[model samples]
Target: MSTQMIFDYVIVGAGSAGCVLANRLSAEEQNRVCLLEAGPKDRSPLISIPVGIGELLPGTRYNLHHHTTPQKHLNDRKLFWPRGRTLGGSSSINAMVYIRGNSDDYDAWEAEGNPGWGWKGLLPYFLMSEGNERGTDAHHSGYGPLSVSDLKWKTRSGHAFLRAAESLGHRPNNDFNGSQQNGVGFYQVTQRRGRRCSAATAYLHPVSSRSNLHVRTNSQVARIILRGEKATGVELLDGTKILANKEVILSAGAIQSPQLLMLSGIGDQDQLRKSGVTSQAHLPGVGKNLQDHLDIIQVVEASEAVSFSEALWPKLLTAMRLPELIFLNKGPLTSNVAEAGGFASSSLAGGNPDIQFHMTAVPTFQHGFNKRTCYGYSLHACALRPKSRGEITLDSTDPRKLPRIEPNYLSEPEDLQVMVEAFEMAQDILAQEELSRYKKKSLRPEQKLSDRESIIHYIRQHAESIYHPIGTCRMGSDELAVVDSELKVHGVDGLRVVDASIMPTLISGNTNAPVIAIAEKAAELIMQRSSRSFVKENRHTQEVE
Candidate 1:
């Protein structure tokens, strides 16, 4: 808390990756670490409940809630993007779907310039942060703080889904993450005893009592203060600066990572001049290549006696079930809504799967936010691998101004072509004999699914992001690349970014787990280098002695 004292590392943004880096880097007896968060504490009960994540948004406490400059692809409508500002970051407020994505997703990263990020190199960190509900091994870890548990009483729809897949000639796999990831099954969730498990609970809670570590909340970071080419420390909103003893690592995430970089005069030279910020680096790719998963859900009418609509009637009676859920930890209350999902290849040429299925127990609005209602099962399909690219630009030199995010959703014609396959796949799923008993004739039958023109029209009207935005500060060997594989800024020293923003390409599943894994691996890399430096200093001292 004192400016006079120097910390080994000054970590900006106490989000998912920041918390993990703080815990791992400050574990020793003498090392000092400072973790700063722009938002308040995570004391609200709404953030802890899986279903309660809905309320976490629309308020200042949990959601930072920044809006993008109107998307040209989406009819000039500015998109509302919500990132958690609390201790755990988006991990606290997101729908707790825990996925490592497919192993091929990481292999594809190696195919790009980043070699050490492949599945073989990254799985150890992934396992290190996981306390699997099943157990421990090469695939999962049991000693970690984050709890990955089974959902409450596999829903009736989940059971129906499994049977439906088998009837459709699709094989059912017990564990999708075990031997492979290409099958229909229930999703693994981020939960502990039926309660949501945020990264703060996983990595920050235990270490908060440590004297060497100082966790500062509501500390807004404006820019990375630099002396020559090195990131000396960070400047606060009050114009006060905290200089670091060793390094300044940014975990501000995808949107804010590039925003802070551009604000600090470390972006495309021309763009920086236009935004009235002095250029610290001429890296053109600092905010380029932005990618996100765009999903469009198809709602249907269900046959009687099967829909959750009839089962959830009598709202007052359903509320009584809360006690049973809390006490016995067995009920619908523990459901993450999106219980079942699948991954498939969109290309008939037999490339790796590029499309994903998200079967929700409820309805989805234009954006992710929606009112609670008893309705038929919902299915969402998003292209896992998109050919389109976008950018994150600074609106102005002001630190308070939100960044301009142009995701360029469906920019490439291929992006829309992939969505068409996704729709056809969803229909194929419903056509299965197992689901026939539950299928009521199309509620949106007249809603248009016939011609290509009709499907594209529906897509333009309905598609929205799946909340996994990444690659704004992409790491690679390309000239446009902002950082190298080591996570260091291309033209600066003593500064590194360890968050989803540095991903070379988007992973195939939920971004939370991969984001946490990035932090875990980055922490080890940083500490190991520090330890080697200490050893070298000791050896030199021995020679002088």
Candidate 2:
């Protein structure tokens, strides 16, 4: 009375990591791979446009617009967290800046017991995943699937912000992904010509014709079907069961990956029982160690008419610029909102930058939901590594329900201290004479925020998330680690979580580039194991013959 289809590999969530897995795993016709996505096909015109991040952030059609529960810190304010729910995941809906964090960040991961994850261990994967427009070098490769290019159209305000940063003693480095990350400059984007090159665009779309790989869109996974402690397959929201002959990979990201584990009765025993899920495995770290970069924006009204806000008001300019974008791939529409940004170190970090600055040529407020009708610029400062940790727990037994996200931002006193220091440091750069030519007035907080306490007070009221959430299912060897060094779920066979969730600690920059590299490594690991099995089987056959 029941029907089911089996796959060599069943990948949950056709997101940034899932798409990569689908592409690599199904390269061999012998291996049948299935990818399931909860969202619809990524056909939105806004998704392809680099500047359309403004249009996509507040909308829910292609975005899982999530909000964290009210934080106990920061006057108990609930922060907005929008993740891309469509094919490419957050990569499709993000600012598209391709930043592969600092080398030390990865080195710290190796120091934390995750071997083959340090920068030295994973540089080949990063190079293999990138198709840098700048061509091949010691640090980059030009012949990969993902395209990385410089901005075709740079704004005057964005350039001025860089000059201002330089005047404040920060050296200008063209490539943030190069030898050192502590510098100021325009960011290279995950774009080709001028359009967004998300993970789906780079890996999945090109391989759509492959018969061996099956991509199912708009199919939400309820939970992984476990046989004892082994993951056999996944059950869909519509009650259809799909079996995995080889393995089941959970690439549902920092939030959902852990939620799925908990739903499948693989999390803390007490928590699973409360959620009406029978406990099968007791992994206490299923949804713990939640981390994210908390960002605060400082807006300055421009003296001249050089902001993206102008094009929005005239309306006709936007219409006229469409052809330029469509044909020439050159216009305001080509701008990846956070056009120019770089890394810097405050007193918080010993040497490397612990804070990052995003200088956008538009006055953005409330995560691009409410744009002020004025020509202005914004300086976004985010603490690179906040000591604060949070958790994701089940809200109910229903898999359709969203999980409870509690980032507990600024819970640690040092986090608040770094935020205040970063805020003050940003003010110093904004006050430089290089930016004096375009500076008009400070829009958000008054220009008189000189003292430390007042700046902290302002950050508490106005700060919001930069949407870089990670570490919910951390990969390490500790007792609290959900995944081991190989990214396999502890105590569960044939199960693994490969996404931003598996990060032991949050990276120092935008998470997209690093996540793609993570998937590349995962693909290698899976293929190596499969190859060894084939060799062993052949030996047995020859011996028996």
Model 2 has an lDDT value of 0.88
Q: Per-residue lDDT for 294 in model 1?
A: 84
Tens digits of per-residue lDDT, candidate 2, 1-545, equal: 44588999999988899999999899889999999999998999899988788789988999997889988887888899998899999988999989999888899999999888888877877877788889888988776789999998888888888888898888999999988898899999999878999999999999999999999999999989999889999999888898999999999999999999999998889988988899999999889999999998888888787667745555457656898988998888888979898888878698788999999888878887886777788899999988999999999879999999999999899999889988887888888887767878889875759888889889889999998999989999888999998889999999999999999889999999999989988987988744334334434543575
Q: Which number leads on lDDT? A: 2
Model 2 clashing residue pairs (backbone): none
Model 2 poorest ten-residue lDDT run: 530-539
RMSD of each predicted structure: 5.5, 5.1
Model 1 misplaced stretches (Cα beyond 4 Å): 1-5, 57-60, 301-318, 368-372, 431-448, 529-545
lDDT of each: 0.78, 0.88
Q: What are the per-residue Cα lDDT tens digits for candidate 1 across 1-545?
A: 43444687999988889999988888875888999999898888677767665457556677888776666666676667889998999988887888888887888787897978898888877766777878876577665567888777565666777777667665676565677767778888888888888999878987799999999898888998888888989988867687787889989999998999999989899999998999987889989989999887776656543434423463345456788777887676676778888877776415567788887765445443554354467678898878789899988778887888889988898888898888777767766676656666555333548777777777776677788889988888888888888888888998999999998788888899899988887886787654334334434543575
Evaluated with TM-score, which candidate comes out highest?
2
